[model samples]
Target: MQVNATPNRRLVVGISGASGVAYGIRLLQVLRQIEVESHLVMSKSAQVTLAHESSYSVADVKALASVSYANTDIGAAISSGSFPALGMVVAPCSIRTLSEVATGVTSSLLSRAADVTLKERRRLVLMVRETPLHLGHIRSMASATEAGAIIYPPVPAFYANPQTIEEMIDHSIGRVLDLFGLETSLVRRWGT
Candidate 1:
């Protein structure tokens, strides 16, 4: 597949069935605010988690992205390496999603796109949201890291002195985007 010679201010966003769906939501919001084109894909389980975690419906969330894809759509634009993008971010990445990306055996568009990002040698950030890790979880993270995927656990920076949950979420998401060098005012740098 031929990659477009032109560069794009584009990114692929994946939302799995993690607890913090707000991270993915805010990521789309910020990407939009910054004029970046976002191609979003959400796992089926993510719809359920979105309903439980936020007031927004699936359609409402999809509205935030420039292009939205169904999880089962393996033929989606993002599923191909030729799709020009900064890379993919699986915000609030569920354990299952992380394991899939690690093993390169993707069952859904979200993980398949992530695997493509790694294979294409582009940045793939996983905002893995979990705690009480077992050896299996650690191994998956290691595997993902070895495969060139950034294993970014959304550990908050209290030094930002965020007063609200929204503020904390914004700060973490901002840092994640920073991995791609897309800076946003959402984060308050220390002593700045």
Candidate 2:
């Protein structure tokens, strides 16, 4: 896949240790199909999650992205506001990652890149993948939202009449991409 991105077509992708690793994987594949340069940063725990949740290996998922970054590489190009990405998305964002972004205590490159995106006044969509909301999780969501991050839980759109899990995943990611003005046919519109 092409790694070079046009001035307006680059996006940063961060995958945390969330259960829905397939969300991040499918997002990368769709980005490639749409000719958008994807800068991927997968947390170490995300790799472990991928092993448990999906059939793809770490290398397989990394290959889907245009550019891949080590979660510990704080100096990665995407870590800076000058990287010129349209925005960033953290698919299957874990509570830990969300809290870090909310508190601005970005210990790893994933959250740091998210912080950079926020500081740059760019869109940062967090596909939070947890249930049983506690007051703490809600507060973190509020804090992240106040900091200009969008807390997008990967909820299934039953109205879309999805027939498979892949369809549901595509719908959620497609909506997330819409926030960055990227369009995809993966979404089944409610009305014709």
Q: What C-alpha lDDT do the candidate models reach, one value each?
A: 0.92, 0.93
Worst 10 residues of 1 by lDDT: 1-10
In model 2, residue pairs whose N, Cα or C atoms come closer than 3 Å (at least 3 residues apart or on different chains), thus clashing, are: none
Runs in model 2 with CA error above 4 Å? none
Model 2 TM-score relative to the real fold: 0.98
Sequence-dependent TM-score of model 1: 0.96
Per-residue alpha-carbon lDDT of candidate 1 for residues 1-192, written as tens digits (9 for 90 to 100): 122323457889999999999999999999888888888999999999999989999999999988899999999989999888889899989999999999999899999999999999999999999998999999999999999999989898999998999999999999998888898998898899
Per-residue alpha-carbon lDDT of candidate 2 for residues 1-192, written as tens digits (9 for 90 to 100): 566677579999999999999999999999999999999999999999999999999999999988899999999999898889899999989999999999999999999999999999999999999999899999999999999999999999999998999999999989999898899998888895
lDDT (Cα, 0-100) at 87 in candidate 1: 91
By TM-score, the best candidate is 2
